[model samples]
Target: MHAEVGDTVVVHGRTVGTTDRRGTVVEARGSDGPYLVKFDDGHESLVFPGPDVSVEARA
Candidate 1:
């Protein structure tokens, strides 16, 4: 997977009935690595996303 800074990242809940999380990519680690994201709740994390994650480019 590939993402650029400013892209939107949607992380699906790991369990049923849980709410999904959304964040903006603040830093991308080359072509293969975890991305640094800033969530809407004012938190930041380096996430190695799985198949449940989707990225939307900034238009």
Candidate 2:
């Protein structure tokens, strides 16, 4: 998926009973990214999205 800055990234839990993680794309690298995301829980990290991740537009 193509993600831009200000987009919301949802990292779904792979297994049952696990909570999904929500974060915003603070920085988007071109192509298959190593995106910089700032999570709602107040931390920042670089994420490479996979099948388990979904991207949403900032609303």
Candidate 3:
């Protein structure tokens, strides 16, 4: 549930027919998310991820 800048965030589809979303953490707020993410589609949004979200560490 925690993420940092440069890390990747995966938002799994919670329901059938919905595709997964992948984005990079543009601005991290530690555990206080509603993080700023830049998606692969060239859009940005503030997302407060839930249990369906996974934060992958930057390597």
Q: What C-alpha RMSD separates each model from the true structure?
A: 1.0, 1.0, 1.3
Q: For residue 52, what is the lDDT in candidate 3?
A: 89
Comparing 2 and 3 by TM-score, which wins? 2
User: lDDT of each model, Cα atoms only?
Assistant: 0.89, 0.91, 0.89
Runs off by more than 4 Å, candidate 1: none
- Considering only N, C-alpha and C atoms within 3 Å, which residue pairs clash in candidate 3? none
- What TM-score does each of the candidates earn? 0.90, 0.90, 0.87
Where in model 3 is the C-alpha error above 4 Å?
none
lDDT of 1 by residue, 1-59 (tens): 88989999999998989998899999988775499999999899998978999898899
- lDDT, residue 1, model 2: 87
Question: Would you list the rank order by TM-score, best first?
Answer: 2, 1, 3
RMSD over all Cα atoms, model 1: 1.0
Q: What are the per-residue Cα lDDT tens digits for candidate 3 across 7-56?
A: 99998998999999999999976576979999989899998978888988
Model 2 per-residue lDDT tens digits across residues 1-59: 88889999999998999999999999988766789999999999999989999999877
